[model samples]
Target: MLKGKLKLPDRLGNLVVDFEDRDDKIGGSSSVLASSEELEIILPNGLGFSRHKDDGDGLCCTEEKKTNEAAIFRASARPYKDRAGSVSAMAFIAADEKRSDFEYQSELKKNTEEELSSSKQNVDGDSDGLLRRHEISSEDHPLSLGKASVWNQYFQHMDIIEQIDRDLKRTHPEMEFFSGDTSFSRKNREAMKNILLLFAKLNPAIRYVQGMHEVLAPIYYVFCTDIDEKNVANAEADSFSCFVKLLSDSVDHFCQQLDNSSGGILSTLSRMSELLKANDEELWRHLELTSRVKAQYYAFRWITLFLTQEFNLQSVLRIWDSLLSNPFGIQEMLLRVCCAMLLCMRSKLLSGDFAANLKLLQNYPDVNIEQLLHVANDLSPDVSSYCPPL
Candidate 1:
């Protein structure tokens, strides 16, 4: 059900299973193929049987279904759950953020012992073993690989954005429309342009710029993949155009001319600092004198785009998975991530005076990507609290 001018990886053209080296077998030898709603994974001889059940660990391939000549692998639930088979599918993309596919695939596969003993549970540990899993988990999300799946999710997000816009428009018809039909290419473009124009119109405080691409990339990918999956006939170009509109809308925030003071994330940080100062005075003073200024250099992108640039694509997708599902009131998961990062750097900050702390945090890449992700996951008191309402 993919649309126009689609390109899959060359190796993915025809799936091949390499079992020549191993003696294990799946479905009593012969040839076994597994089909999910999304893809078909073929198994050659020698790959052992994998169950399609959630045995506390993760989704597994369960049983092989038969039809006269050949057998197809289908997911199965073990003892308790009704749609046990569905758990396999659910592992890939669960509406429940805490138990979703992204959360299951951790990064520290081989180096489990090396992983920080922090309370945070990272989806992907920094192991070579989990890298592929991390990639697989977020392959469906836009932020991971920036494929069509991202476009699909974007459509859902846009639906909400438009829903909000329409509600606002009824009260004020002069308000610009933010939604567009996935099928109408030209209209989608026009609609998006109007939307961007409206964003500029609405937030005269920010002007259009090129760097907004980073934010729009994830949105567009989410929209495209979501649309393709839902409506099968939606044009890829149309989804892309809509994404462009989104970028156009946020252009003002990234304009180099805009300083930290006006409407951008710097403003958000200022507000956050004020909130912290009032709420956690000691932490605020420590951060201001030490990590805060350096945080400005490193934390700007994190705050502005929600760590989209800081971590790799897979990590970003999973992070957003938690972020989009957050129910907490702060409304910004990125802020929490910033808080987590500062916490991770606490030892360095505590060791030095304000200047040393600034020097250390700014120059040192002490917090690896995997550690940061773990901290991000753990920092949120409630994992469910990090995800914004869908």
Candidate 2:
């Protein structure tokens, strides 16, 4: 057993790890070298694939006729790489950190104390290596169901995620951009499916998670909606390139090991609560301190899925405009947007009890998308001087 602390690198998060399993040089066998792709991802997710089916990547882009306009449009639009630092600042702060605006410091301190009392490990221990033996094959050892399930889930994660992506890609069928009972719509879905699959294949660390297609939808839509026909035809290639750039910073959210770290979704939720307290102290106290509502109860999906599930497609598209354009970074801007969401419902959240407030946030009421963006932009007025019109 390898006992020392082994620090693994993260490519796409350092997904692929090459390990020397053994030093035996029998017949110069290169097969002894184990890599991230030790096992093939073969779980069927409604989308059929024969054992011999080609990866479908080459056919996706080559089938379209190459055009000079396509190349030009690709260069002009989707400035994600150039505008890399797009989010607003102050993203993931620990519960007790100092803030600019007036906040409920005492109550926040109490909450942090309560969290530690639960024996929850903080950022330092978030990515602890697996300690327990994965397999116990002895005839005398009865199988532990818990360990078995964990083993299976860890190994089969890619397949399960592929199945999930298959289902989520069918979202909003009524929309003209991605669905319909026509050749055009089918072609669009195919292109999107290809992009999603390509992304998964490229980033083995985070193959595909549910609601990711939602992240891709607006990007694909914007590309398809391009006026030039060649650019429209070349949407898949352009979207694929831009999508990779778009998710580069936010990929940590997809890594389960980092879930509790400063980069994970929980840390983000903490930052969201902190942002709320900094802006609207009473409302923040009412929900977290008085009502004892955890940010994860409602904000989990919002923060993790980029608010795609909480709002409709059009509203989501509008929200992404602000998120992608912010100068801070997606994570920081996301916390601000989440805080703004709570602020928008200030009157309701304040008067309501735990049950009432929980219901309201879980089943979030219809919101003014433009106004929500406005509130997010208004947060931390001291740091940012220019709030772009949404």
Candidate 3:
């Protein structure tokens, strides 16, 4: 008989497997590990094992005769990484044809739930650790139920709520999910509202703002339309997690107190001006002198709202794809995009005066998004140098 315990790393979370060998068969159960949605097992000597969902049962071997010969077993909670770099353990096993079928199903379900709980922990905590102290409550706001509370937390933030509601009613009017008061629309609105409320509650410093809905719309839409149907139901929860991740990087722009901080929008605008000067000094000089346009006049909206208000929905989404995908962070990509937008309308911008240039920038003209992104990417290779330190 053999008995031992296995330990996984911090990245893998706490996963322990305890095994015992008896009567030529080995049995063990794995403690829940992070991201354990699916478990993969490899039997020694190329013996195959298949699980049947129709009838809950113990794993079945491809060849009945080889079952008795199976002496070594390896199970992984996730895709196996390189063993050389990964921490691992070895255990020997013998397959038993008479193992309890119900026990296997019960264990599988328990493992799944543990993995889910672990995954939620990762999403909630995030990389910056801002979310660690905040606890999300399932209790519906009093406004949702129309029931008054002692503190009136919901009522205290009614203005923000009303703004969010009004924006939800007006946003993406053409899209079915955002258009009517239908079930889908309500679900999306509720998701957005809940996220904003929780965010404000968690970080009172940045609270809810008017244009935040626009910033959150695309993220919710993308998550809700996930290709995996299993994930669709949890779209709202997942979107909340992702929204927090996005905001963690750019939250300074939304906080007025941080205006002069290195991470703030004012600093971002200064960096944008530097980038423009480097990329197109003549165009930069023209905008500053002839148009009397300063970075803050237009960049306040562009930087804070992430250009969401400037471009059409389709174009905004495309630009966001580039912005989010950039390894250098959103601010650097944003400045480049701002520069590209200016350069794209160089002729019109240079020819226009103060009012005309301001109008053109505030009401950005519709341009080929692909071309715009291409131009943004084509800016100086050392764009990072111009970006303010985070």
Candidate 4:
């Protein structure tokens, strides 16, 4: 159901999950094992490294440069919204920009949250402990003497809310030839609603944070848009499974306790800094020392939210195409994209003061999406075409 190939760690050995970590079944054969390579991301074309004429600097991401100068895009700031999820980016690519799946998922999530929130009047402190109450006290409501059965109440309301939602979504069936008010629509809504509700229920530690809709939206969109009729029909279940997998990889960024651990957000930020340093030390130093810009100041959202906020939805999807297929895994690919973002704005960043640079970085500028992604693709750690960012 996934439109893009699942980005897997290289050690996964052509497998999305680690192949070597297989359980010791009495015996298992290679033929019987499923192959995930079909889903392995392949660059659509022209994004590949091109051989350029020789200049003194050998083998790099150069494009017909007479002096073999490092490639760089002239960055310019026009406008941007903080993009929040790679999953959302991927969701946009399954079809045209206008009718992306991410939109559908987020809309559904919003509708669900509002429905659930408005139903219970006592959503005051907004704590998991508070929400765990199956029944609110009569004194809290002051009007109803009967107790509330949260489960029964939610289900009863879920049907009504979902029906309303299906009616709304059904109005626009022209998009991707999607059916309106059909069994599939009801089923899809129920599945997506359950996934969102269940995720909130299971992860009581963090509860349901905002922007999760960004993550779940695209998965459902991508699945429902799948060319296969059967896959389109099962979009909800497929989306639920993919959302779990995608969220699992990123949930640590949301957990407060794990903030300083080796696997936490801080560690990821450090790695991103190191990635930038390896690719362009001067830029790294200027941002870190000259500008004294903290990684967390700008990179926290970039890393955690996955650049959904950094660029237009279309641009993010273009980058995510490579990210989801990077073979090295999403984390590594993401850092490269972030670094490319910096390099794209090299001149401004180099000349700007701390405040200016910070402001610019925080509100990343728009650039040629193709060039930006190409620069990022050239920044791979293991295989460098010496395509140093100018």
lDDT of all predictions: 0.46, 0.67, 0.72, 0.63
Most lDDT-accurate candidate = 3
Per-residue C-alpha lDDT of model 4 across residues 256-288, encoded as one tens digit per residue: 899998778998888878888888899989999
Which lDDT tens digits does candidate 3 get at residues 1-390? 111122223433322222112222433244333442323334654555454333444333345423432233234333334333434333112223225566788899999999988877777777753344555343444434333442356565776778778888877787888767789789888888988888887876678877888888888888888898878888878888988887777788888888899888788788888888888898999888767799899889998888888877778889999988886677778888989999999989888889999888989978889999999999984445644435
Return the TM-score for candidate 2, rounded to 2 decimals. Answer: 0.55
Query: What tens digits encode model 2's per-residue C-alpha lDDT throughout 1-390?
Result: 111122222311111111222224244465443432222222233232222223863222232222322332223222222233432112312222455322777678888999775444543355463343456554324343354454544545557556754664477766765667678777777788888877886776788887788778878888898999999989899999988887776687788888898678777677777777778888877888899999989888887778877887878888887887888666678778888888888898889999999999998889888888888888883233223432
The per-prediction CA RMSD against the true structure, in angstroms, equals 39.6, 42.7, 32.4, 49.7
True-structure lDDT of candidate 1: 0.46
Best by TM-score: 3
Which is better, 3 or 4, measured by lDDT?
3
Residue lDDT tens for model 1, 80-165: 23322323323433456655544555544534645643212343554433333234455575565343466554554465455434
What TM-score fits each model?
Answer: 0.36, 0.55, 0.59, 0.50
On the 0 to 100 scale, the lDDT of residue 86 in model 2 is 31
What lDDT is reached at residue 195 by model 4?
Answer: 70
Candidate order (TM-score): 3, 2, 4, 1
Model 2 worst lDDT window (10 residues): 11-20
* Clash totals in order: 43, 7, 0, 13
